[model samples]
Target: MWGGNDSTFLQGNTNPVSGQVYTMYHGTSMEAAKKIRKEGFRQSVAGMLGRGVYLSRDLEKARRYPLNLQAYQRVVLKVEVNVGRVKKIDKQGHPLQNIWHDHGYDTAWCPPKCGMVPSGLEEDCLCIYWLIHKSLSLAGVIICRQTKHLQGCMG
Candidate 1:
C-alpha cells in the first residue's frame, strides 16, 4: 500500500507522499560521476536513511554532498525520480528511519531543517528495489569548476 501524506513533509517542490515523478539531484566526486554515467547508480550499503541511493530535491543540498570532496572534484547530477510509495522518516530516531523499504516504501524522505540531517536540508532515499529507470534516471550533470571567483562552484 502507498503511504499517505503528512503536512510536515510537504515543504518541498513535490510532496513526498504524492508518489509523483520529480526532478532530483545527486552529488558525487567527478570520478564517481563518470563511473555513474557509464555504469549507473548503486545503492549505498548504509546511510542516515540507509541502504538506498540518496538524492535530494534541493539543488544546494545536492551540491554539498560527497562532503569530503572539493568543489573542483565534485559533480552534481540532475535526475528524474518517480518517488513511488514514499515513507516519511522526518525525525532523527523514527522507527522506520533506515528500514522504510522493508515496510513497503519505495522511497524514504527526510524533510529540510527537520534536524534529521546536520545540514538541515531535505534528503530522499530510493530503495534498492527501485534502482535506475524503474524509478530513478539521470537527466544531466553539472560539473563544478573552481574559478578565480569560485563562480558556479557548488562546493
Candidate 2:
C-alpha cells in the first residue's frame, strides 16, 4: 500500500477477549497517491464491504476489524493501481509466463510503468505506488494471504 516514512504499519490486533489477530497494514501518501489508492480501495472495498462482488469473504472479515485509516487507505490505493496494471498488461497481450515470475510468488517479472512518470520525489512515490498496486492486483489471492511481502510504506 501507500507507505510513508512516518507512516505506521497496520497490524492485526487482537481484541484479547476474542483472541483473534487481524492482519493489516497502515501507511500514508500524497494527494495523488491517495486518489489512486481511493480508487483501488473502492473496488476492493466493494468486494469486502459489499456482498458477492468478487466472491470473497475478505469483506466480511474486513468489516469486523477495527478501522485503521492509514492501513485501509493503503490497501485501497494499492488495488486501484493494480487494476490499471492488469488492464495494461492484458491490452498488450503479454504472455502470462512473461507477465509473472516462474516461482508464482514473485512480481518482478511484471511490466514497468512504460510512459507514466512523476515530476519529483512526491510524484515519483505515487508512480511507484501505482506500479506496485497493479502488480499486487494481478497477484490477487497469492498476495492477499502473505502480508509479509507487501511493500510501499517506509515508516
Candidate 3:
C-alpha cells in the first residue's frame, strides 16, 4: 500500500498472501504524508470490499491461517446507502445536511449522458465516501471506521 505501483510494491514488499510483512520508515511532512496515507487506506479498503473478502493490506500475519481468514470475513457490515450520495447525516457524524452536500449520479457503467466529470479538487468538492462505505457495509463488507478521518470522506 505504501508503494505507488504494483511493480514498486512487489520489489520492496513481500506478497501479502505469503503471510509476510516488513516495516519501512519514512521521513516527510506529517500533514502531507497523512493525506497520502488516508487516501491509500480508502483505496485499499475499497479493494477488499470489491473482492468480497477481507485481505489485510497492512498485516499479512493477520490472515496467515484459514481460521483467521474466516473469522475476519465473518465480521459483516449493515447500513443504508444512496446511489451517489449519503443519507441525511454525514461522515463526520454530523447531525444535519445542506452544509457539505454531494451531488452526482453513479457512473457504475459509464452510461450514456455520463461524460467526463470534473472532480477538479477534493478540497472543493462534496464527498461520496459515506455512500460508498454504507453500500459496502450493507453488503456485509466492513471498512475501517478510521477512514472517516480521510479528507475525501468528511462529506
Task: Kindly indicate the candidate among 1 and 3 with the higher TM-score.
Answer: 1
Evaluated at residue 72, the lDDT of candidate 1 is 68
Q: Which stretches of candidate 2 lie over 4 Å from their true place?
A: 1-22, 41-101, 106-155
Tens digits of per-residue lDDT for model 2, 10-47:
22121111111112221223443456444543222221
Superposed Cα deviation of residue 135, candidate 3 (Å)? 10
The better candidate by TM-score, 2 or 3, is: 3
| TM-score quality measure for candidate 1 | 0.85
Ranking by TM-score: 1, 3, 2
TM-score of 2: 0.17
Q: Kindly list the per-residue Cα lDDT of model 3 for residues 1-155, writing each as its tens digit.
A: 22332211222122222112212111123342345344521322232012112222222222122233333222222122223431222123233323323233221111112221122101111134533453322212222222335411011
* Model 3 spans > 4 angstroms off: 1-41, 45-68, 71-73, 85-155
Error of 1 at 12 (Å): 3.0
In candidate 2, position 131 carries an lDDT of 37
Q: Encode model 1's per-residue lDDT on 20-103: one tens digit a residue.
A: 777778999878888998998989899999899998888778887788977667789977777888888879789999889888
Candidate 1 local distance difference test against the native:
0.78
Choose the strongest candidate by TM-score.
Answer: 1
